[model samples]
Target: MTIYGSALIVFVLMALPLYGLLLTSFQPEAVIRSRDVQFLPATLYLDHFRSVLAPGHIVPIREGIWNSVVVSTLTAAVCLIVALPAAYALSRLRLPGKNLMLGAMVSVYFLPTTIFLIPMFVLFVSWGIDDTFFSLVLAYAGFILPFEVWILKTFIDRLPREVEDAARMDGCTHLQVMRHILLPLVRPGILAGFIFAFILSWTEFLTPLIFTSDIKISTVALGMFRSTIDIQVGQQAAAAVLTLLPVALLMIVFQRLITQVLMAGADR
Candidate 1:
């Protein structure tokens, strides 16, 4: 096919689903009930959006959104802080049992989260962190850490050692080299890791389901499912759409950065 044809094909494939979602979000219940579904809503209705945003809703959808934002942001920040240094050390330093340490970190990623749910629940309760925002944040951080470390480590490994060597020759310490030289170079990796951690925490359901009993700690995903179980389809759809808004916005705002990060290690 011609270049223009390929571009048109890509645009349609990407735009169609988003158009459908936007159309569905505005649709009234009657249209949904109609045997034949149209591309556009016959009558626009904001009731679903209002109901989902309503204060009296079983799960305060706005609060759930805020909780999710907080949890995801904190999880991403923590993952970056912990993962960057650890990944750099693992990638560049020749510490004893380096392979074993890397193996252990990777192994954690393969372990089923379900297997730890009960134990984590008990630990949270024992620590008096259950049903708290901190509990959820901690759980999310742990859940995202292993994979974040591995993803970033690969990128860090690809960084040139000459940069660090020059910094050292200038009488710079390892910490100074990392702060000034390494971080600037590996920013794409950091962004990628942060985005991955945030998405994972934002969409997590099982950990919050098992650990948090209070609405305060409940995230958007948990709240959406809770509303669904009560047969509130319209509101549920609204909540889902709202939950997706930030992610969609992030992808749009940082499209170039995300694209670069995604392709960073491909040349290797």
Candidate 2:
């Protein structure tokens, strides 16, 4: 196919779902209830958005958004702080049982998250962190750490050792080398890991559902579940759209970094 044709095909593939989401967000309940599905709404309705954004409805929605943001941010920060050094050590330093330790770290990803929910909940309660943002952040960090470490290790392994050696020759400590030389080189990996951690934490449902009964700690994913006996499909759709905004914005803002990370990995 021609270049323009290929571009059009790719655009269609990406645009359709976004178009559907936009259309659904504007659709009224009656139009949604109609037996035949339509691409265009009969009448545009802002009620769902207004209702969701209004003070009465805003409380749960805002709380959920805030909870998600806080948890995701902390998860990303903690994952980077811990993973970067560990990945550097694994990639750059020679240590006994390094393979075994790397294997163990990778093994953590093999176990299903569901298996740990009950134990995690119990531990959180025992620590008096249950139903708190700290608990959620810690859980998210643990959940994403293995993958972050693996990805970062790959990137760090690809880095030239000469720079690190030079830093060390300059009388730099291990921490200094990591801070000044290693980190700047592996920024794309760190960005990729941060995005992954944030997305995982933001969309996590099971842990939040199990640990938080209070509306205060509820995430957007959890808040999306609160529907009356008679479901409000339009409102739910609106909520889903709004919940997606931050994630979408994140992707847009970091699109260059994400693209570079993917390209770098692919080149390897």
Candidate 3:
């Protein structure tokens, strides 16, 4: 009963903003201009959706979408590339002071990313890559690597050592065992890490704001600010809704995988 009550309360809290998002998205511009907050609209309108889809802004909605997708996908991919081996080493190998290194990594993760913004910007500008897609991907991947490493490390730690040993005994090389056996076994954790990294990059406002100057390379989160400046309330709501669409679709598609991956660590 206590759990049910707590769940109901949490649901209501989450539902409130979502309800407003829906209501505002469907409301007519005239209704919005009147400055009244109506929980229920008598009717629906979609001119806002049309406008959001149109190309009228400094950064076209389409291009922002493309840039965001590219940056996020690359960040996720690159982060995993860096994290997987490190995680495997920490989990399976007799690395020197592995616990201390992990604690340090966790400390880095917990440290406010904003603290590094100015220094990172300086480094990027020095390297002549400031305001570029690569800069954003690098920044996001750096920030996301710790979590991905930790998550994958947890997953790796749980795998049976006997299986890996058996594979080695069968003349399977270490690379072959990892590629064929271990990676496939922990795929859900990897997928979850990818999703996490992607979403972190996608929704990130600070890193993109600092690193991106070209409208052509701007992301959806930054584009929202520029696109909605002179737009009506309804259109703004539509833009917000559209920004959430890809994330929503991703969650819908990977919900089960994410659940399994998250649960896989919880039992430890």
Query: What lDDT score belongs to each candidate, Candidate 1 first?
Result: 0.83, 0.82, 0.84
Model 3, 1-268: lDDT tens per residue?
9999999999989888877887888888777667565677868888778778777654356678888999999999998999998898898877889999988997899998889999999999999999899899888888889889988888888788998999889999878888888998988778888898888888998998888888888899888767566767777777788888898888889988767766876785
User: Against the hidden true structure, what lDDT does model 3 obtain?
Assistant: 0.84
Q: Could you say which candidate leads in TM-score?
A: 3
Better of 2 and 3 by lDDT: 3
Q: Give the TM-score of candidate 2.
A: 0.86
Considering lDDT, which of the candidate structures 1 and 3 is the better prediction for this target?
3
Candidate 2 per-residue lDDT, tens place, 1-268, comes to 6999999999989998887877877888888877899976677789988787665573367667887888889889999899988888888887999989988977987898888888898888998889888888888888888878878988888789998998799899998998888888887788788897888788888888888888877888888667322447777777788788888888899898767666765764
Instruction: Indicate whether candidate 1 or candidate 3 has the larger TM-score.
Output: 3
Report backbone clashes per prediction: 0, 0, 0
Residue runs of model 3 more than 4 Å from their true location after superposition: 1-9, 260-268
Candidate 1 lDDT at 248 equals: 81
- Model 1 residue 31 CA deviation (Å) reads 1.5
Using TM-score as the yardstick, the better of models 2 and 3 is 3
Residues 1-268, candidate 1: write the lDDT tens digits.
6999999999989999777767766787777667797976687788889888888688567888988988899889998999899998998887999889978977987899988778889898999988887888888888788888888988888789997998899999999999999999998888888888887888888988888778766788888778767744556667778888888888888888777666764755
